[model samples]
Target: MVGERSKQAFERAKRVLVGGVNSPVRAFRAVGGTPYFADRGEGPYLYDIDGHRYIDYLMSWGPLIWGHAHPDIVRAIAETAARGTSFGVPTELETEMAEEIVELVPSVEKVRMVSSGTEATMSAIRLARAATGRTAIVKCIGCYHGHADSFLVKAGSGVAALGLPDSPGVPQSVAERTLTVPYNDADAMEKLFADRGDEIAAVILEPVAGNMGCVLPLPGYLEAVREITRRYGSLLIFDEVITGFRVGLGGAQARFGVLPDLTTFGKVIGAGLPVGAYGGRKDLMALVAPEGPVYQAGTLSGNPLAMAAGLTSLRMLKRAATEGAYDRLESYGRRLVEAFCQTASHCGLPATGHAIGGMFGLFFHSGPIVDFETAKACDQALYADFFHEMLAEGVAFAPAQLESGFMSMVHGEAEIEKTIEAMERAIPRIAARRR
Candidate 1:
């Protein structure tokens, strides 16, 4: 229930905020309802303004891996804020954060911090262009690499959620430089590269394809992309902004044994704070300015509070990994998706799901959902009904079917049971509506 208070809040926000929300998806446009305003979150539960508590599977869109308001991250942010939030000068905290990332991620030899995923990706493309001396970049259709102009041509997530084909402001010439191929289709990528290999500077993709739901790479798909990019003399850039630390300790690169020339990261690395990073081969990173020619600078790139929170979160994850926390997370996701699919089937509604580490997707369609084309074929109306009913059952999934559901370390067995119980009840009722 988005209570009267939240409704009023939205009404008030509409006077000041664009579409009554800072982000388009948050407005609940895709789900066809007013959004509930979150008051606070604790562990895996979010409390809304109406005093409703829901088990949060969205987890702030995949950043709250340890769940909300974890004491460690909060304390880190508070302590670093006391020291000062930003100085416009580099801090040792930033260096330590960089070292932690370089140590953990297989593809990154050196890193440059930025304030947002968009910054990391935009800067990465610039560096790729400068290093390869080519203007064209290749990206997968429906694989979102942030909101950088070049990436919006065939983006997913909010762009798909809002039903926008492509944004208006990006120049056609800029769009032309960004070649798009269907995800999980190695031959399409190969054909494109074969046709215009010399014009391509880089091939960028979400290694796990989180944007168009939690789509996995086809067997040998990532390796094929890597081989093609290498053969074509184009850089391979993995946008791990959503999957970075969430999928595994070393990200998709370490998990899949495929390394890219450059990697971009966000979400879990910042521990619910605003931060992003791009790093890879030392020679390529050397091209970023102050050390080389490609110019990219941000005042809050390495803000102490973000660095502290991120470092604390990473250290926590690293320790937890040693204790099989990630294994448990993967298990939780698997169990939940299995339960969701089973329940949907029992209710005589077709459904499919995939769970990889802490990320999962539930689709109202029979699936071997390999790419965006298949992903878009899911039942949007059924999902929207299921979302609202699940809300009524006191569980929170992503507002739209296109988004991925995240599991946190704090989503214990009890929470998992609670969610399944909610789904068992919600699914049949929603399915009945569809019938």
Candidate 2:
């Protein structure tokens, strides 16, 4: 329950914080209630400031794969912090971190570290343009690649969650360079490339679209896009900020056996710290500064603390992967999806969901929800009702219908069972309310 203290805190926050929250979705406008301010988190659980404990599926919006405050990760951050927070000088830790990524992800032979996913993505596109000598870039219609000006046009997630069509400051001229095609539509991608092939520098997409509600790629969709880009002399860039390590020991590319020319990463790599990276073929990444002509630099690009935390998380995942951890995570997610769909069916409410690796989505639509156009048709009001009712039953999902729900490695049978029961209890309340 949102207690008096949390309500008061939100009231006070409104006096200063924009929309009473740092992030728009955190304001809870989509879900229609006051958002709970997090006090702290433990394995698979988050405690709000009002002394409420709920099984957490948000996982800090897809970063906490190890769950909150794992001892190894905590120790790594602490030890690195004690040595000195940030040093302008280079450190071997950065080299080791880069090496780990190069070794684990199949397509990345070189990397440029940045502080956030937006930086990584924007930097990658700049490199893509410089390499290809083309000014135009193409992105999937509703796949978000962070908040860079080029990405603002037809973006998803937070932009969708808050009901903002598109950000105001992105110039129409910039938007003109970005071509949009519906996700999972191979023919649309092919037509777009054929029509504008010479003008396009790159085509960027999420291998598994995380933004528009965890939608999966259709059969051969990624392969088709890869072929189309290659045929047109445009680069293929996968924005794996949410799916990177969360999807597998390698990312979606390695799992699906389809490689992109470039990849962007954040979330899991940072292990709940502020970090992001973009890496690719040696020749392309070689175009980045100090190594080549294109210039992009960040003073805190490879901060030791973030490197330590991320490196530790990656190492732990490498070990756990051999132990069948990824399979376990996928199984747990499938169970939740099944339970959600089953209970909704029993209550005579339409519902559909998808789960893969550590990410899952719950929707108030009967789905074959492959693209944003289809995803948007879900019953928003029903989702909002289910969202609050589940909260009252002590389970926390994403505040918006369009966002993906994440599962962590630490979420085991107990948490899964509890969440499913909460779903069962919460579903009928939502259905009955409409009566």
Candidate 3:
């Protein structure tokens, strides 16, 4: 529990790095504490610079599905790196990765890699605009599609954690083009299309929203979106950055049986490396440069290291799929959710928990959370208390209530049991703070 080294490191970091962190969420601003500096991760555990270890539920914000530095991924990266880091030229690994992605994901026909999720989404939006010859894009209020100017309005994750309605630097003109709607509300979406169907280029969203604390799509909502978008001549974009391989071999689209026109992906695809991709119908993806008019390019788009790591991860996932990896994830996820509910009830605190596959959320509220408003209504102060208490008990969770906690294949029964025990012990202490 001693974070002396981390505290000292933070003091040094703030003198150089912005907010003493590369990412805003790592600042621990919402959780009211200094961030712990992780030294390394092995299996499901993270060891910090202060010589303290915790059972990690963050999983690098949902990318390390196979757990930290899986030998195969490590070896792949190492071997690829030994050849050359960046060629800025074509490589067979890129083709191999593209083939693997197309084979695994039901919706993707052709994919182009990018360095980050932000780039993938930004490019996808551009493609949508070009293909439909329209400008405005519809985004769910709490769904985050990265930091692109058009997507900053009412975005979730770090923005929600900081309680910012919209980022400051985005121009009014850019924000105006993006329409925001509530998650899981079919009528509102229908009305949006009816009102501006002609001008709307695409409707983009997280098919299974993870940014606003792992909210799942309501029954029939995704289907409604698919049908509505198709009817309106607008493309549907699934920002599967979190859910792609984490949900299943085919992702949320396959899990829910709704195929989107375009899908933006990152996270699990990279196996903890920096990579992102967007792909869909062959005709639509063929529009990207060198093939057609729409333009998108990256210097490190398909870097050998990233491709090797991604390929290794995807291959492992494909193999695991046959052996019921998702089934085990569902079983473990349900156990964790149920455990949280039991612990919350015992502590006399109302709680709502939900999970799909390896992604889950623990809402500090009494009832189901369906949209941004209700999701926000969950007590942040209480969550902060729970987060710190759980951290103290050697369990690491996302520091913000709006971020979902991830479980990995490495989080076995022993780890799950330990996590639940930690939650049970931490809940009383967190509850005591409220009184």
For candidate 1, write residues 65-112 as lDDT tens digits.
999999989999998899888999889999999999999999899999
RMSD of each: 0.7, 0.8, 0.9
Question: In each prediction, how many residue pairs overlap at the backbone (N, C-alpha, C within less than 3 A)?
Answer: 0, 0, 0
State every prediction's TM-score relative to the real structure: 0.99, 0.99, 0.99
Backbone clashes in model 3, listed as residue pairs? none
Indicate the TM-score of model 2.
0.99
The residue-by-residue lDDT of candidate 2 on 1-435, one tens digit each, is 677888999999999999899878889898888888889999899999988999999999998999989999999999999999999889999999999999999999998888999999999999999999999999987899999999988899989877897789889999999999999999998888778899999999999999989999999999999999998899999999999988898899998989999999999988999999999999999899898999999989998999999999999999999999999999999999999999999999889999999999999998879999988999988999888898988899999999999999999999999999898888988889877
**Candidate 3 stretches greater than 4 Å from native:** none
Model 3, C-alpha of 105: deviation from truth (Å)? 1.2
Which tens-of-lDDT digit does each residue in 1-435 have in candidate 3? 538899999999999999999999999998889999999999899999988889999999999998998888999999989999999899999999899889988989999999999999999999999999999999998998899999999999999998777888999999899998999999999998999999999999899999999899999999999999999999999999999989888999999999999999998889899999999999999999989999888888988988899899889888888999888987888888898888888888989878999999998988689888889999888999889988888999999999898989878999999988998888988878677
Q: Would you list the C-alpha lDDT of every candidate in the order shown?
A: 0.93, 0.92, 0.91
Candidate 2's displacement at residue 303, Å, is: 0.9
